[model samples]
Target: MASSMLNGAEGLKLTGMRSPHGLGSMNSTLHGKPLSKMGLTPFNLRKDAKFVAPKCSLSSSRPASQPRFIQHKKEAFWFYRFLSIVYDHVINPGHWTEDMRDEALKPADLYSPRLKVVDVGGGTGFTTLGIVKHVDPKNVTIIDQSPHQLAKARQKEPLKECTIMEGDAEDLPFPTDSFDRYISAGSIEYWPEPQRGIREAYRVLRQGGVACVIGPVYPTFWLSRFFADMWMLFPKEEEYIEWFKNAGFKDVQLKRIGPKWYRGVRRHGLIMGCSVTGVKRQPGDSPLQLGPKAEDVERPVNPFSFLLRFVLGSIAATYFVLVPIYMWIKDQITPKGMPI
Candidate 1:
């Protein structure tokens, strides 16, 4: 653990990030949410002086740096824990719908009769549960980095064929072309090196294989260290498609699973995202490389969440903390454009 920390520190140092450890800590607390503006103290306000002035509009977006994947000896554990805690509180059986399961199952190419499926980021078998119900788990393996979270998932062992493997997403410990169908729900977004992981997925998938990655994107695009850290994961739609296709995924179709009966939990952070589906191209086939896809159609908030945010925003505004509290409440919910 100490060595890993040293490596993390060294990696931070290499990037020339100021107080990488501190930034990591702040990023950890922010989770997938952006920073709350109202929560800023006099000190934080002073720190943000460069942009807080009248001349700063915060209107124009700044250029985002392309990220190199972070290789950590330990697999990231926060996302798994986040799901565990979320399920603990809000198990809206309604939230887990057949449509989601059906849509989730759509990417299965059924490479073989045994159906060798690999489920990445199968926390508590949420995505795994949907897949097992739809196909043969006997040929399935759930790969995750956290033992504690995986163990919690293993307690039930709903299906005997569902095996769990502990490993990293960026550097998968598997042979190439080993899987027929690769489905990752709420997984790839967590990849510190998403491109590397995408390429790895391409390397492992058999020809004519289907690779569906449900990478996350926030509805809110901002400059908070909190937002930058995660937003870095959920790039624009084409950016995601290009990442996989560039890695050799053909017929790479990045679809937005929003609009129709979208999940309210998805737009937690004022930003909306889409579910991206890409397929590994057969050799010699020119992959689907197209111009930028349109953003998801406008979506209204769920009744419950909308009411809550309205109430909170109103209350916070009265207290002169509207921006901070509103952002906090927004971040507290799931991301918009409906991610899980």
Candidate 2:
């Protein structure tokens, strides 16, 4: 019966002994091991039998020169070192507000208190505070590459039970399929390789689990675009969807969110613009393979270059900080139901 299912299937030709039950049954095996043992569930087999990978519409190629001043690991590390002092107080109020954090995490589907969750690039416990609202504090783990940022997260009383550690987003330290939900907020912009970090998100999630990434979107206005380019990664909406599909996630979805003052005016772009969620259908590492790491952490850095990038990056970052305040002032004068 298992053989009958593949009778007319194209490209896939089953060879070797077969069980009486269909491939959907647990009796099926490929090379002496049960298909179930190999992470090949009935859903995967049925999908693979006729699945043709879709061609990505967007180009994966990057620019020759580094566009953003703070996109690299080293630059971001030092950038956060000082920013961590006022991140929760200043940055959160203007950009990553409590309201925005709650809305962004909703698609992550943190429904169960028993769910094991890993908040990747979770800085200062701002987003983790939202995760703890749905899941138990002990069940959540917050990982970031910035030690200074993690130190601030440790100070939060509500997140005391949550595990806080310093780790890379592009290369997570956790084992594959170790988490029920993978979440990252306001962090992808700093990643030199956004796709690699997204792949890790897929790799760490259990089968049937969800991975939600919330980050900034590119601005349309000319002035905002210039500042956004110099600041950090501001990926377009299509780029986010393409990255998730390439990572072998099924049921991919994206939800747009921003501050109330914005009034859906996305021409300027918000710091935390969209929430993208995808579910892992089958387990193990992501299918998309890449050559090497974009940024080498062990490599020596030049003192002069480091200081230059840090200064310019901080200057660009200040523009984003002021954008929300400017918008808020406009929102106040504008009528309640009108766009600011």
Candidate 3:
């Protein structure tokens, strides 16, 4: 048993494999085995707060030099982290959808009746279990930025089948057109250039791949769900639809999953964000081949959207006159250069 050293930057249980000396120990919560290159050790089981933006709202702006999202452990505790956590019921077949009632739910083949899923930013393995029963773990990849979270996943995760890859969403370390299905489950919303993450998903998806995205659950009020980096940026469905188009995904379906309340106590669940499921368009695919592009997506516009903004603009102006700034300063603290 080699000794493990904690990397201050990431609260992950880094093993020796990724270390230069190859002397680091495996993650504590993972399978109690030697780790490979900060390797994956699956175990399983388990497990957000108020994300307040300062003068500049989260989606409003951030320094280019800064990471899109910072997972500050101590401060992130109060977050409603349990939204992804569903314990004990993961192995139950009764919980599966009608399509998978008789058959195993395979995330890898989401459209083909199987499921090869990569749970991007999949923290705590809550959703993985939900996915595992529906699909084979071998077909699932739990990718996230935190080793600590991955460690927790290892404890309850189905190691024999599922995998844990540590990497960033904007610049994934996988080859292009890799996964059959992809999901963020409300995680990618934290990425700095959320578009990049969407593009990466598009890049690594097989033709006809389905990218199911779930952003934070919030009401219609813009500021109501305007959280910090954890729930910081929310990209327009158009942005994702555009990236998928550019990256070769067709049949893009963007639909919002609204919030669910329990007994009138607003449970911070999925709401007010769109779930985009797009199929990767292959070479020579026709312009009229598949689904609608982001620009073409149509929904009944809530007339009040225009009215509310108009009213807020008027009322806020009455109490305190203000002028919106068109030219904003870009932060250069973080690397904004193109990804490798």
**Candidate maximizing TM-score:** 2
lDDT of 3: 0.42
User: So what's the TM-score on candidate 2?
Assistant: 0.81
Error of 3 at 72 (Å): 10
TM-score of each candidate?
0.56, 0.81, 0.49
Model 1 agreement with the true structure over 145-247: per-residue lDDT tens digits: 7665677668756655687888666666878778777777666654545666677777677776777776444333233323433233445443565576578
Q: How would you encode candidate 3's per-residue C-alpha lDDT over 118-216 as one tens digit per residue?
A: 888777665576567657777889987666666668887365467887777766787876777777764654555555567777777777666666553
RMSD of each: 18.2, 12.8, 22.0
- Better lDDT candidate (2, 3): 2
Per residue, candidate 2 scores C-alpha lDDT tens digits across 1-340 of 1111111222322222122211122224534744333222221234233323223322232331354889888999889999999999888887778877876776677888999999999989999999999899999999999999999999999999999998999899999999999999999999888889899999999998889899987775667767877788888665776788899986665555667676656567578877778888898999999888867899998989888987888898998898988888987899876544
Name the candidate that leads on lDDT: 2
Error of 3 at 211 (Å): 1.7
Q: Candidate 2: where is the Cα deviation over 4 Å?
A: 1-67
